[model samples]
Target chain A: MCNTCGCNITPGNREFAYKPVNGKTAVSVLENLLARNDDQAEHNRQHFDKHRLLTVNLMSSPGAGKTALLEATIDALRDKYRIGVIEGDLETENDAVRIRARGVPAYQITTGSACHLDAHMVHDALHKFPLEGLDILFIENVGNLVCPASFDLGQHKNVTLLSVTEGDDKPAKYPVMFRAADIVLLTKSDLLPVLDDFDPERAELSLRNLGSRAPVIRLSARKSLNLGDWLDWLIGELVQKRGKLASDVLVQPVAEPQSISSNTGMQG
Target chain B: MHEFSVCQALIAQVEQIAISHGALKVQSVKLRIGPLSGMELPLLEHAYPFASAGTLAEGSILEIERAPLKVKCEACGLDSKVKPNLLTCRMCGSCKTRVVSGEELMLMSVELITT
Candidate 1:
């Protein structure tokens, strides 16, 4: 039994407690529940920044061609830039295998029962995955539009894919997911001629209605159609990231004892 | 749902606060959930008991305060409350608006029993 709390809770089993309280005083703990995850995400971002890796998180519904887009992207930019992938799925190594077959280094994070891939999982994946000599690292998030948006996977940019078959009203229904996207991709455009029910205009309109001004690009990874625009976007982001990195290097200060002292104070 | 996962995080936070404050147990936890927080209140409520089962917050009550979805219009510069699905500016009806609030999922306070 614990004397202070009047509970039989060990530190190990303290996480599981069932008891009513007799109070004397109350303390206000104003905190963000997502602080832990956010902190981990910031740490991951620092890692990416150190390696100068332009990280992109791909979010979308299942079968929205997140894997297919990665394949196409790797094929198009492999010669110009070294690419890596961190694939997140609920089960199986299917997506990672596909990316590996393209001759690029890939890591698979099989989140057994978790609906979304949190930053802790990504941090763990970074241990097994090599970050050296890679210009771009794409994190293909679990194929869920809702939960994935709530998580920050330490990505520099968020690319959300909305296939034409998923209906035009999806943005209206899944506003949070769409709103978080830095860029929205309208995938499976090859079927657009056959499907008159799904309006690309309506989809963009709905996304706009959600106050998301992210530019939308229509492309079909399978058909290899209009993939250049997507490639250009990737290159543009990479160039901008490299430019920032170069400036950061130029602005790097000399080792100072005072700076170290200030950093020690910040540790608290 | 992810609510269970979120509730677990919330419970863990509450427990930490209780221990740090040298509290015997937690009486209640207050939360400020915004419209754009991506959490369903009913689902979160359902998952709370299971998440808080064996912790200091086991029998604690959850007092949730709902926040309105707010948007700032760039064109009109009006800060107004708007609906989740439709994020258009309420004043100038401009689509060029920015979300100023309603994406929060914060643990406002924890009422602890220190006796």
Candidate 2:
């Protein structure tokens, strides 16, 4: 505790804990919790624009197969376009390692106890990223369907994974996430044939009820079913976004960086 | 889980304000939260004490102002509060409407005390 004031002055994580409160006077102020995050997000947008980068923020619940989808995506597109990933999780660099194994530049942001990835995390990831001429960047957010919906990570697109095993009513239960999604990917479709409780029609109804017009694409990354649509959507977006630059990155001049370079430890 | 993080940010904001105004403590924080804001008030309140632990804002009250979803009808020009699942204008029964409010997750004001 501070000797001057009865406030905490810890020397560690909460070091900035205590400061002397000003002399006896009442002060009025107004601010928003999201203001700082939004500011950083705007800055990230400018940076992506400068590099002509198309960034995607992927959010989903645990076991939603986000990593798997990303792996398959990288495999299909790595030969065509320069891809990079920023994997977010509460703990573990394993996700980043997985993406890097696919020969794509991957960075990881461990959020500690935080449930979502904010713009500040993405901004920091970009600072040390060694790859250049990246046509597409994907920030795979921490696997939490509820929290990640609230924070914007300054991505060009927000793709949410909804595993079929989780049930069809998720959109109704979590309207905010569904409403914010630019694309709702229904993963684990291979198991849908066995899961009797899940209904794709009901999911569509729920999305409609929530006033979401975003397209829902069902696919099983394991079986590689209907992945063509996902790739096609991505290709169309990249082609539209890069304009002339699309031709350059599409050529795949370099082979896949299979050996995960030491400097790209992805943990910074 | 998200609420804890959010409350931490709120407390930080409050602490910054207290420091800037030379206040001894924070009394209350008034907020406007809409349905679309994606924050659960009860969770936020529950996380407040944890966020304010050992801080000047400890025991501070949170005054929440409800910002219901409101939309202005483009076809009929009538603006009013709306239901969460329904987007049609209540007056003319038209679907041609745009959101005007209820998306706020704003800190309206803060009450602070010195000494």
Candidate 3:
């Protein structure tokens, strides 16, 4: 019988309570959860490597001009880089249609009310696309600045876009997303001169205050101002990352650091 | 927003624990939610009932304990609790502090009643 809870448990219950147990079991289970995602991410990474693909995850709020930037990016880089896109949304295939109009292969993943896209979803999407002969792959995460920051979509880089219309305090307000980002893109730069709230210097200061040293690129997709620099930077980064991966694969063994680090260490 | 999805995951965790313990009913669930976890408490609580329905934790009460965000100061070399939105060091006014803890979202304990 148990005396603490006053439960009618014979000697069997006592044995169950005090038996030698492995404490590491709980830690192992917790590790397994993160490890499972990392395993899927590594598989996706290898897929990217085999094809020499550069994957970028784009995160931003709804109506923050993510699709507009994609349209402009596809228009600019499609001729130079063999670009592909995986668009995530709650219920629309609108963004995919836009990307496909630019003559690049695009896939739409409707999360069906899920806020974020996990690595498993990206892995499945990779099978749908012809991975051979692709230079760059863009993943437009569901229009969310918070939840998407927590998920790993097997991307080489994560970029957070904040528009001039959304004000400059976004980096300060949502530090997690900014902290996790490899690049901070200030979209709709043309509106900075018109809007009273749009202060580029203040925005940069706030972004710096959030401890993100990621290069903050200012460009207006609508006006095509300073977009050349943005496209050039992206193309250069994609080429550099692909080259590094190929060289690493040629040198390192199969068991090298498999997990993708969320921090890309790219500072502006 | 994502609180509903998190609630679903929490319910799934509780159900697995209940089944392993041979528990027919769940009494309570304790969770440690950090201040910097970006989870809204009221929204999570509102979504919990819908998520827990028809599961072992159908009538279980979810007790949440808030953990303060802890940051490691680069200048002072001290660990201090700071506000969620503020990224400044508590001991020294250095803005170069790194986060060490208080981003936890875990199921700490569960109470189950067996038949």
Each candidate's TM vs. the true structure? 0.90, 0.79, 0.80
Give the Cα lDDT of each candidate: 0.87, 0.78, 0.75
Q: For residue A210, what is the lDDT in candidate 3?
A: 55
Question: Judged by DockQ cut-offs, is candidate 2 incorrect, acceptable, medium or high?
Answer: acceptable
Task: Assess candidate 2 and give its lDDT.
Answer: 0.78
Clashing pairs in 3: none
Rank by DockQ, highest first.
1, 2, 3
Rate residue A256 of model 1 by lDDT.
66
Which digits, one per residue and each the tens of the lDDT, describe model 1 over residues A142-167?
99989998888789999999999999
**Which pairs clash (backbone N, Cα, C closer than 3 Å) in model 2?**
none
Which prediction has the highest lDDT against the true structure?
1
State the displacement of the C-alpha of residue A65, model 1, in Å, after optimal TM-score superposition. Answer: 0.4
Q: DockQ of all candidates, in order?
A: 0.46, 0.37, 0.34
Candidate with the greatest TM-score versus the true structure: 1
What docking tier does model 1 reach? acceptable
Looking at model 3, residue A191 earns an lDDT score of 85
Per-residue lDDT of A159-226 in model 3, one digit per residue for the tens?
88899899788877887788778888889888887888788778777766654567888999988988
Record all residue pairs in model 1 with backbone atoms less than 3 Å apart, i.e. clashing.
A16-B54, A17-B54, A17-B55
* Residue range A70-145, candidate 2, lDDT tens digits: 9999888888889999999989899999998989889999988888999888888889885467879998999987
